[model samples]
Target: MALLWWEIFIVVFFVLAVLLPAAVIAFKPQWVFFSRGAKKSNAETINLVRTFMTHYSLPLGMDPLHRQLCLAFMDPFVKTVYSLFAILPDPWMVAICRAVDAFPGNTLRYILHAIIGRTHLIDHVVTEGIKRAGLGRCQWVLLGAGYDNRTYRMAPLRQAYQVATFEVDQEPLQQDKLRRLRKCAAVPPSAYEDVKYVTCNFNTERVQDVLLSANYQPGKRTIFLLEGVSMYLTKEGFAQTLAAIKELCPDDCTLTFDYVDERVINAYNGRTDIVDPPTPPLGSPRSVESTTLDEGMSDCEEGAMVVDKKTAASKKEEVASRASTPLTAEERRYGVQYCSVLERNQTPVTFGLDPSRLETQMAEHGYEIVQHWSPDELAQQFLKWPGGKESKHGGEIVSRACTYFYYCTVRPVRGSAV
Candidate 1:
């Protein structure tokens, strides 16, 4: 007997809901890193694909860059997943992302878009650092660079500055990346002239020694890209890694990274005031775009304040009466939901900074904050562009989640080069 249309639909949904995820997990075990690992570097591949989807679905998607960087690295199974997401309609695809979450706002689409825009921001920051490194003739080092294809994607970088290095902890993922690079004919051997890959556990190994053994030049300045990596580390691990960078590199070196704010790190309830997600300059197409919540405001206490949307709405009058400085109706509902989603994740933020003392704190560590961009700042910048199609999509995501993260570029203080 033939089944009815609704029955068939139910059957297909059941298969996809149960069998598909199980198949993905079994065949692509690395995908688990996207959801529940302490060391989630394994999920970098999954993250890369999500970023690819962000570019794939949007008008501003830099098809060329993502295609060159990500598409070539995906295995057959991953390729199938990518194709499915890419082929589906935008709203339907976005719903697929959102459906993963029980709640509406904290959807997979939001997270994917966040990854895409932020990755673009990182790309721009690293590109600038690369230019500086080229001028200084320093080596480019990507610490904890997981599934990062920047070395392979930017032909100009390859042609101009040849020295590059990618350091990762996991051997399997590193091996897989290497294999994929070899498979993808887009980047030939001549393209990656002086590249090196170092495999060492940052927690236990001396990162300095690992690089030194890899023929990394100690006297030369270096461009360090430490993206999406610090928070997972223990306090001791974080300090040790920073110490290694200080001890090994010269003062002329440039370091670009993003971090969680102390407020978010130690938020007791889901009520931390919004801090802008980290962001970069607006010079390049890939650079982060944003506006200031208030002029010269460095922290939440200043003019830009964030409050829990649900709580603030109920206590608007009471809150306004209690505090001389109260968040506007908009500011409380404003900002990215990224942190709220992160709070729900199994992996918790272990370290963060106090924005008020950022400059001083960095100074104490022999580093100076060259630039800092909050999420609000980034979104404002994005909205300023004339025909920023991608920027609009990315700007919205960041604007919503900006309070959850912070971005900055830091350089070693003179006479304190590590």
Candidate 2:
């Protein structure tokens, strides 16, 4: 049988996305972190690619950014190619997005599992929040904004962007993004006139203080998008930031963030008790015989071959159970390797929370859940389910990091607004 295009694409994706990075981390521990496509921090680069998909014809609808930001972030040559796509009419761009989306077990869904889910969840929150609070009276903040261009897209100069938009991130990252924006020929110097950037280190200064310094008013409804930041933060750092959100506004704010289960944190910390199936490295053989079956297991196999029909049927059932249950171990391996990559880069994951205890944890911080999406829900809601055996193999390789992850939008329990 010949390989399909999607299958070939998957192979390439695994090599560039998985194996290459793993080799780097394994050989170059305690070194700088980056992939072949990276220019700055690996986190920002990856998030930029992921969130940039908001322009694609996603099921939740497209949230487009300025074309120059998109082009400026890419390599000079890649930016030229991206510009070709960016310059296309909306219908053509939509067609291109749909084409990529239709590929079976598409790379977009597998790689973007939790991200797409987070996008959908936050869009809902924003739309609803705008309705209730009125757009002009609300604030929108992107915490740890790393290459995020939402503020740029929603700046009042671009449209009737009534809500105040603020972006908060580390100083170096914000500086780099600003540099790129100013240097891009397609973007005007005044492109960032409307968005306020808050350069912050959450460990020392509180979020409320920094946002206030940036002219973020308290008591009005706010939507804080804390994306892909918690796991990198220490538990104490995460809690302190959460407390700041509470202090910023009461009852009226919507906070969206995601976290991994403690087992993921355990994996990062080199705990062995997780007991995931021993998945082989990408492209490695599935199994190898240590001893000739003819020498040792031949007699057992020959003996078992004479089993009654009932016994053979029982064996078949066991194999079937392996497929439908326990989900997969490959994703778990991906999750572990991801942690390994960051850990080697000296930015190990330190904070995680069990999804079941999410509401409880938020309650302790004076918040209540508005919506929560587990990994299973995210897969079903965002990615395409497998149709048959072929896609089942790809689906089995669904990123385990996504499985451990959980997303939610929560609101304060009481009004601190008055």
Candidate 3:
């Protein structure tokens, strides 16, 4: 009995030794800081996997050579992880990829390809813009730049254009990233020269003040790379950030960012799994139901509105009933599952824009769209699979259906439009 108990204890100890750290990392993004600490995010992990995939996929003659070079500039840990996977056999890799929830089997190929493609497209556009306008006179600003190594990798552009990358996030996360960077052997001392690290919550921070403090010149022609950040912010926060950019950046300064479509946010058109809703303005009435939009006009008039004077669930309900469309059986299932997952993760996606309203929406914030690409457009242009007709079309269909990612470039509209 004593020997059997000892064996069980040893087995339990080993199990925890392997599982505890993995669980911590897997659930890091959902963790609340008690004493101010940085936890891993889904975005960070996606970046790592994407970079690793890029390194592997490059030799396959799938992606552009320059993109492969860019991957070489990634964080040391990312590179190390990629190197480990690169040495692994295809069977082993497929098994590991299959085990991941986000990317199952060969689906990872399309996902990684799309990510790398979008990244390459952005880099090409920005670099070409810089080259055209004279590199030595330009400035590059990567907003919400998390673990992105573009500044360090673009040797020619950085040497000439004088890049200044700013990463704004919670202090704890910023500290953790900087700490990692310091420990990275792949990064050199000179890599620090062109980049400036700024720590602030973008939703609350004054962009003008933050930029000025970071030695950013508002007058200089700048290229703002706002990648993978919009969905994380509320609508007001998104608008405020854009307004700050407009007020602070030069008229010609270009801004590029990706956003999820409003349809996806609302989980419309069979996309019931996406959890998102447009964030209403400040002082907006709170809803008992979080997903529904309060679109009804108030009879109380603007300033005369009283706070609890309206336990008026009836009025709100009437308005919602009038304005809200009924959901289908499929949609209801998708919504329930999506919301359940969202609540479990403790992260609510509260911002999305209708693509049809893109031009008007951007113009409202003093920005005019220069170019845009949908998921289908991106896939048709960039995705290439190895097999025959059936495989290619199937992959493209999967990629096209993924309308969550979009790329758009905009410039500050001058004159009365602002």
Highest TM-score: give the candidate number. Answer: 1
Misplaced by over 4 Å in model 1 are 1-42, 53-60, 72-80, 89-110, 132-136, 268-348, 382-399
In candidate 3, what are the lDDT values of residues 279-395, reduced to their tens digit?
444556534231111222122221011224243344333322322223344434433443333344544556766554566788678766655566555655554333457753333
Q: Judged by lDDT against the true structure, how good is candidate 3?
A: 0.54
TM-scores, each model vs. reference? 0.66, 0.64, 0.64
Candidate structures ordered by lDDT, highest first: 2, 1, 3
- Off by more than 4 A, model 3: 1-39, 59-86, 89-111, 268-343, 385-401
State the TM-score for model 3. 0.64
RMSD of each: 10.4, 16.3, 13.8
TM-score for candidate 1, residues paired by index: 0.66
The lDDT leader among the candidates is 2
User: What is the C-alpha local distance difference test score of each model?
Assistant: 0.54, 0.57, 0.54
CA error at residue 96 for candidate 3, angstroms? 7.5
Q: Give residue 99's error in model 2 in angstroms.
A: 14
Query: What TM-score does model 2 achieve against the real structure?
Result: 0.64
Whose TM-score is higher: candidate 2's or candidate 3's?
A: 2
- Cα error, residue 55 of model 3, in Å, equals 4.0
